[model samples]
Target chain A: MAVLDRDTINAVREGFTRHRLSWIDTLPFLFAALMYFFAARYLPLGTQVMIQVAFALSLDLALGYGGIDSLGHVAFFGMGAYAAGLYALYVSSEPLSGLAVAACIGALTGLVTGPLVLRARGLTVVMLTLAIATMLHELANTSAMKPITGGADGLFGFKIAPVFGMFSFDLYGRTAYWYSLGVVAFVFIICKLVVNSPFGLAVRGMRDNPVRMRMLGVNVTARLVTLYCVSGALAAMAGGLSAQVTKLVGLDSLAFLVSGNALVMLILGGAGRLYGAIVGATVFVALSDRAAAIDPFNWLFAVGGVLILAVRFAPQGIVGLIADWSQRLGWVRR
Target chain B: MAAPALAIEGISKNFGGLRVSRDISLSLPVGARHALIGPNGAGKTTLVNLISGLLQPSSGRIALDGVDITNLAPERRVGLGLARTFQISSLFPSLTVAENVGLAFEARFGLDRRLWGRVRSRPEIVEGTAALLQSLGLLELARKRVADLPYGQRRLVEIALVLALEPKTLLLDEPAAGLAVSDRGALLDLLLRLPEALTILVIEHDMSLVFRLAQRITVLVEGQVMTEGSVADIRADPRVRDVYLGTRSHG
Candidate 1:
């Protein structure tokens, strides 16, 4: 395939521009943004606000578009958090600078490990990602990087400075919430542009059939690596946002449970549908919060059972279920 | 006048102790419609696979248009003007018939990276794909997805896909396979009407279609070339009669 020219790129971007404000197209971001804004005003301080949204989006990209069943995505998220925390504590307190460092570190880690994980297909890919996440979690718990990462105690008390010297991060949770909301909106737009690009088609085609894409002269590995890096950077940005909001970074972010939760969110939302990620994230977090209010220890079991049922009865996730119902009702047809 | 469009020199492929293809060599000159026929285990498909670069030969060289393409990847071979159709219908089922053919046009034109533009909106790709599909009697089904099309229509779309590549040499494996008699005749007629500058190699089990379309015939049996000649010569050969036609009555 030839390189995309100006006309083609413009055509693609234009295609997305037309659908930018369509009801279904805009709902995910709008809903998520509104919820974050409201939560910023109402919720108690010290909440890990951005973690669910970031995890949801990253998982969506990896599994939905990339067709990779990654259970190690949280590794990038946790690494990003730690990287941002380290930058805030040591390099610079500037939130933007911390975010930049996190993104770079996340992307680099993804680039280095993506090929090894993606080389395997189906169940193997899932298993490999799980292994990687587990390893990262163990590494974070070790004493080797104790001074920097805080080892078992984890990194804490790292202050997030203003946004480019313009907005100071207040203790009332207003600044962090808006900052994260803005970042999510920006990343969502970028992801939308990417997944709608020719690159997106290629990725989807890879999901459908890698052999066919290769026969069509698509560099399958390169595309996978590119996607991995992009996802990594986004996940890292989310992590940085989480670190800034929560004022701490911990090994729990890298744990298998965290990765598993992200996978559940992606699948619960719908594997390939972009908005499914947001839906999944929202439902998951909301349900967890509600269940915890009732009984904290038993919520995991309840959530796990619901997740199993979702996979069994609604394999396509909630979005898929809704689409199926809509089709049955003749509401929309493709 | 020049080197044959494709020349396979003593190509052999062995799978462990099983000899899949043994000392197979054939030259297909420009415009020649050469048919390879064999029984159940005759390695006809295997030979096509080897030539198409899906499988490597244990020993031999394959040259296309005087260029050695023995080690080239299948897609690169396509870039070098070699195209093949699968025995079973192979198509992008989710894509529209036009898009399926357009992919080949895009590949040939090197426009694969123009990802954002609507593929069907490209005038060149659309016109060329439409014309090819029209020629293959698939114009009416152009807007339909391959998955939604009938088996015969899908096969026609597959032919259109290969045609869209504008290859110098076309390798069709069982193009008439699973088609109705009338559809088989139409496919054979399409093959016969192909431009004389294009070299065609076909692997078929249908003796009538083979005799009707092939300018020359090569018979393979038990992974070896049993015989090769014109249709009449092949028909008259006792060895071919004993191995293929003669043995059929018992079944």
Candidate 2:
């Protein structure tokens, strides 16, 4: 009774600064680090997986946790690729700075478009995101923008500086692997902080019952806009890493296929959970690589088959399946 | 004299050609326990919607603590110490009860934007969630997910979630709906135990529960206040019996 009194209420809240240690969070990073060492021959594939993981994570924040389903999340990725590519060519060719610049552009795009796009509900918001990404894609494809964007030919002719003025991005993609790994770790950390924070719960509450959230004094649109900006920035960093590693920004970077692939990867992995993106990225990228090597054009059939199976059997996702098993085994309570 | 907890003056709302609320007016002084009761389609929920800023009144003003809040956004009204619950249980199905109840403190304490800290580790949130749950006799269910709870327990959680915000006024739309007899008893006891600082307006079909919980009753029939008086006065009124009480029996 005493505790429920208004006087006992702490008007100012603190203690949100500490980062608690969790075995679950470190497991993915450990696996990524170990793979970099043990799977040296497959660094290129591993690197691509890491980038996908990073990109998928960004989408997970928007679509999974925030419930802002974006079909064209590749907008940020494309913007980042172009931003980093252009920055490398014209500015300094510094990898970190270029990545930062791309991230800013991505964040800026989200900030600019968030209020407008998030204004729509449900399918309309998804369509608006798709439209925005497509418009950017078309703009980059146009001849008028070719001088800057390199148009249909894609952006290249830029040398990415050796990461941190030391490690060269060699033919083996060793440098790129480490760099992308770091980005995944960093992005995962950011998402961990967000999804576990009060803001994160508020977003989830809004996702479930927006009217209840409104009655609780939360600005749902404003909160989602902020999440969109964060997600966009993280995704841009993923794109920037791709540009830095490959030294090429192609039309495919901003293509609709890239966005669709990300969505599928997220769904396959499971949405909302932090580890969903990681698992999804690893499985999808590895499978896609293997399938593409065999069929090239017809590989999507294999991917489609797996997706249908996943939807039916593991709708909550691979991580969710693991969780269910653990719970059933009395490893965790319901 | 410190201004009524809530006051609505001649508020009316129309949808297309349909009048959902007509020149409806009600006021709740500080610490008032009122019930808004009516048959189905009598616009009880409509009036509540208008008060909570979910639906705008075509005319008239709503005041909270002497401040005109008719134009306030629904979310903004909450900042002014107004809160509500739906007849249908609206809760974060996947989140734990502690998380759901902690959401209010999360927003009110301005921690909603803190993107670095885990919600559970924060002492303020942890202690506040525990305290609220304890006071409501819901501590045992704190860690349980809302989706896993029974319907009766979920209703109780919904109320606790609303009360977590510590709003001065609470608008409950059918708080006891679909509750078993024992569940209704628990809800009644919890409501009775609430502090005097809170003012509650409950919309209910359960006449017995309303008779026990609410001190003042406002009866609505077809978008109009059919009668308003003390609980005993309304219970004894022959007109109320003729209009509402005749068919609406108590257990």
Candidate 3:
């Protein structure tokens, strides 16, 4: 038998606490990348799912960690899509700069609306976020901006330059797939770093008990707003990636359906855990795509059935369930 | 004595038409141990809330260390060396015990806003958290989630959280409310052993613990102060006895 006293047990556990992501954590990313070599025919579909993962991760940061409960996060996503699409069309076709421009616009949008929407909680927050996204959607739909936004016809006259002025975006979408994967990896790394930092801990604290956090000398609202903007920028970059890869930005980018779908993905995969975003997006996108091909009219029924099963069996999300099993098997200690 | 560590002058609060706290005034001198006792709905918690800036007072001012903080936010007041624990054991339930206390240390050092480095890897936070948990005899449970701990242990964590801030003044709301009879002694011992330089305003119903740890006692009734004096005076006061017997079914 092991003579493990409580103090000795705790000390040992603390010594090896996984505060930062390890090389093993990158295995999933490597696996996702490796899949491209085998599934060349499905590269575009995989790229779209990866973009969804990036977007879902952004939402997870705010809705999962920050307890933001925003239903209109796609506003930033849509804004980024349009910004990148328009920039490539009118200003510069540099893919990197397009992402940066989209991120800035998204961050700016978050900065402007965060204070107002975050001031309220629960249903009010959801409603205000929806209103903001709806307003932006309506603005994009207006005929006055038709000359610029394409006015529901969708923005399509854009030619994105080759990646880093080298590898051209090919017909097979191999470059675009790798490009989206790279951005998603970069964003995922940043998110991991953020959630492990002191700021991340404080955000989690706010989610658990804002009153306690306030009494602990935290400027709760300021932190919330800052997080909102950062998440916004990241989500926008994902949108920019989507625009760059698709060569199209449409009204659907800013649609409530997009926001609702991302939220659904977050819940299906789980929220607080970042990997949940990855798993949720991949599973949802892949299943939905396959289901649509199998029976376009009845695809919703398949997706709904899967969601019901996931909610019933793994309400905490796929990551949470995995975490539980790992802990039980002594493979992980959370 | 040193301009009072905390001073509440003519503070009153009203929710709608019902007055919860009315002209309740109290002074806590530097390094003093004061106890506020009252029956249910007597506004002891309300008064504590007003002092801690959780609830806005309709009238009056609260000064901390010669600084008027009546209009300051709760976080700002905490910056001014005011700390408090909730009656309901407010904690980051999903986080581990060490993380909970570490957050307080992070807050005290103004590192709560640091967005770059890993919190657990910081030597200061890790060492500070260990030292704090060791002192509270909770080093063993550091890895356990706050939500998974027993109710009494959660309360101790609450106290540890506040102590990690190292505030000059602490407002404890029902710190000993639901402890087993056996645990109250340890709770009292912990309270008594706190540094003499820290002024504490404890709202407790445990007369034994209060009478032992508190040097001064202030009794309240129906949102108003009934009396204030030394423990002996408070214990001997017939009015205090009458109020206790009428309000308290069990200690």
Candidate 4:
């Protein structure tokens, strides 16, 4: 707790300085590097958790900053997973190129659907997003797509080139883990820069009072649609990372359960605060992994109880609650 | 001949078979201070909405600088140098006062699309916001979130945001509503201090404020123009006294 308090102080100070990275901002990358060097046994799980955190960050930008409440964000994730897998099989074996392809596909999907979907607010938007994701899921499961997507069997049998022609993806998964960490660090920095920019503030303004933002000459809907696409691309990149690291793409990536779990993780960590995604994803994923190992049926109850407690007590998520406490303690102003 | 800053002809609004605003037409040449006053439910807000393009006129032609703008969107109208303040003090509550004003400056500068640079690091936006906050006596509260401000300060912040747009035609919907008696003077001072060349239309119920600020006053009754005259002419008009003013004393 004292460590977190110190980190919070540094984070606030860094926020005011603008564009400069502080120890707190770079701590995740440092921690990931340290873990890779020392706790090598847990690298695979760490990689998975980083990908999940990336997914959470994407949702944070949309639902938290843009006020785009979505229930089918996993559509982009699943699409990216498939796109990455397909690219490796049919187009290229280079992992980085596959990831880029996946990102573009995800962004294209958002660009195509964002206008039609973002026009509605509240539950209608949720329903539309859910419908689109479900449609993709069904299409992937169909017999026509079985040869390509592998149907319920999932897609496998793809090779990823070594990292910079040096680090081969070993059977122990060390290379994959480091690659995932690098991607997460890059995406995190990008998300940080985005939310701190004038464009980002405009998004928040639109979320608060779109009518007023429109009066300020902001193309509110257009801005939101653009944000949605960017978020979609980021989410897809996370999914691509997962597919590349695991060497498999599953239909479950697009399922409502994936979307729901990501949302639960975000809310548990507290939404809006970027680092909340990291905290929530790590805690939720690690806890769920342990809980499922102990008792699969009882795990749901434990997850539900934690979510309830998190919502009731730490409504801002752990990060937000900590920030509030720091403010009360006179450690930070915001 | 120079075009009127704003011109509305035969404007009307209906909601599901019920007419809220009847054929209302008015003109404001450059630098005109026009005030629209009416009793409650007289569609004053609806007319403002129509002019601001928040509501489409059932039938009318609205123009900005002689260009027909009846079909333009609200944001497009804003792009054409038109802006309005809300009666309800619409603002980004979670953001700091400086950030709110900075957003306005960024929008005016067409820098709102910039997604890479940190907003606070931009000298033009920072200096402009500080100057604006200082002008409104809100310099000390610049770093304070809008939600933390008093009601009057929040209203001033709203107007400050509007002013940051450097708009040519400003529509203020009850800018003085909810302000304390003492605060109205500050509000009045702020409005009176604006550049005279900036065209302004105020929708206010405060008669003294209206008379003090407006060069021309238009009174509406049941969505139609009841009278159009100077402040003295409005005070003398018997129909305005009987229908609009009635027994309520002017503040």
Which is the leading candidate under TM-score?
Answer: 3
Q: What is the TM-score of each candidate against the true structure?
A: 0.88, 0.94, 0.96, 0.95
User: B1-251 in candidate 1: lDDT tens per residue?
Assistant: 79889999998999999999999989988888899987888999999899888899999999999999999887788888888888888777766666666666776676655536544346666566655655666656766767898787778878777787788999899998899887877787788878888899999878888888888999999989988899999988988888887767521
User: In order, how many clashes per candidate?
Assistant: 1, 0, 0, 0
- Clashing residue pairs in candidate 4 are none
Candidate 2, superposed: residue stretches over 4 Å from native: A2-21, A24-26, B249-251
Docking category of candidate 3? medium
> What would the per-residue lDDT of candidate 3 be over residues A1-334, giving only the tens digit for each residue?
2233556444723732344678867876887778888878899999999899999999999999999999999999999999999999999999999999999999999999999998788899999999999999999989898888898899997999999999889999999988998899988988988898889988899999999999999999989998999899999999999999999999999999889989989878999988899999999999999999999899989879988888999999888788888999999645
Fraction of true contacts retained by every candidate, in order, equals 0.16, 0.60, 0.60, 0.56
- lDDT winner, 1 or 3: 3
Q: Of 1 and 4, which scores higher on lDDT?
A: 4
Q: A100 in model 3: Cα distance from truth in Å?
A: 1.2
lDDT of 2 by residue, B140-210 (tens): 78767788999999998888887878899999999999889989999999888888989989999888889
Each prediction's DockQ?
0.28, 0.44, 0.54, 0.48
- Stronger candidate by TM-score (1 vs 3): 3
Q: What share of the true interface contacts does candidate 3 keep?
A: 0.60
Candidate 4 — which residues are off by over 4 angstroms?
A1-20, B249-251
Error of 2 at A212 (Å): 1.1
Per-candidate Cα lDDT values, in order, are 0.77, 0.86, 0.89, 0.87
TM-score of predicted model 3? 0.96
lDDT of 4 by residue, B89-203 (tens): 9899988777788889888888878888888677667777766666667666776788889999999999999999999999999999999999899999999999899999999
Interface RMSD of each: 7.9, 5.8, 5.9, 9.6
